[model samples]
Target: MASAFIGSSVKTTKGPSVAGTLAETVAAVSRWGNQPSSEDVEEMIRDSALARHAALVKYLENKLAQAKGKLKKVEKALAKVQENLEPTELPTDLETISDEERFLFRKIGLSMKPYLFLGRRGVFDGTIENMHLHWKYRELVKLIVKRKNIAQVKHIAISLEAESGGVLVSVDKTTQGYAIIVYRGKNYMCPQALRPGNLLTRRQALARSVELQRYEALKHHITDLQERIELVTSELEEMEAGKKFEVHKALYSKFDDGSIPNEDEEGEEEPFSEVEDPKSEEGKLEGQSMIPADCNLRYQAL
Candidate 1:
């Protein structure tokens, strides 16, 4: 009985080995002979897939590099805009310029009065309309100086209030020494303390104010737009880069799994075939026939 059991084991083992070897050989022939054209196409397909993956990698790298450059450029532009937006303090003392030095100021519809005062009274006062007109005069004077047509003025003074309570202006000439007290629409010659200087035009001052304000506003708007663009561009680049990385990973996995045909080798090892059970139905019948009568019939048949 022991010898019989050993023999049965040997048979089982030998049968599997012979069948496995036959199956391997048959599989090899079938793979080689039946689908040569399809195999070639599959190889080409795999090569194309690899090429596509490589191209994608290169594209993603280039995009990232470009995005970095663009981001840098945007940053520089934003910085420049911010710098330009900052308020520049005007000099308390006006710098002298050539007769041709000129600046333009747009009109802001405000009016002022020109006045001169001596002691507690006014010498001359007049209504001046439009602030931009004063700015234009100042610009013209600077331009004339820049062109060497006129000397630079050193001082400017203007009375902003009524002459009785305003500052004094004095004019001196070869034959006449005069003091002026000027308020809005009124002028008087009076003896009082005098303040001597050139005065800025109201038009010019208003124009400068408007220009400065507009410049600041435009700078802020540009800065905000640039920042938003930078954010969007960065996000887009990141998303595209992530997608590219995922595709590369999947392709690499495929290559590793041998799903892609081996380009260097003409052939590869065949996959093992699955074994099907022929006695499955018989086994089920025997399992169900557990009664004594069924067992006796099975013994008689054996």
Candidate 2:
């Protein structure tokens, strides 16, 4: 807001002199047809005074206006300095560069922020929760959990430039129900799976390290798939229990009271109607049937 009283102050102060001169000229005006009188001479003096006063005022206004403009420029510069003196909060898209990180960036002659690599747009879309973590590392952790199908981070650690081409290392956290996944890159080696001790050559070590990392990374997924296979196998077993498993009836000590039913036994046998008589009383099932070839004959449920 520029001041409302800059050149106007000069105009106000010098305005009275101009008005006074004009008033004297008006008072000195002669009555009709009186040009040669003393009134005319007084009028001329008054007009000259008015012109000089007006010029003085014009000069003052120009000088004052120029001074006012300079003052405004000075005021703006001072305000910017004051603003710089006040502390500024960190921007949302940027993390505070630590002294060590600053040193590293200076060494490399590259200025990069950790948040620049975290691309978090549309991650939680259609999710029931509307919240997001505040920091980049936390967001990266969240991304890992979301992609790895896990709920919470079990543990997190960082090593500067831990990966082969990595510049820095970090982790993040997020919301959802997912399993945990750990990725250690090619630097991790397994003593039990691989040969004991380090590799024989640098090339062999690098290749073996990448291979081991791949296997280790896929190990959990393979286990999860195997679990799903077992689930499906159990379901199939349950569904086929009656049609295909009736052959185990003979191993069950079921006699149907030993009174043979009216079904013909001379023709093709009924697989579920002819079990051996029970030795133990309580393990008998309701009907008799042929024993399964794979049945364990020694164990009885009762």
Give the candidate number with the greatest TM-score: 1
Q: Estimate each model's TM-score.
A: 0.20, 0.18
Write the residue-wise lDDT of candidate 1 on 1-302 in tens digits. Answer: 99998887873443445546878889888888765587586556555545655554454445445445545655555454333222222223322222222111101100112211111111122212221233333321000001111111111112222212222121111111121111211222332333222222344333333344444444554454455445445544554464333434444533232432222431232343433322211111112111121111111100
TM accuracy, model 1: 0.20
**Which candidate tops lDDT?**
1
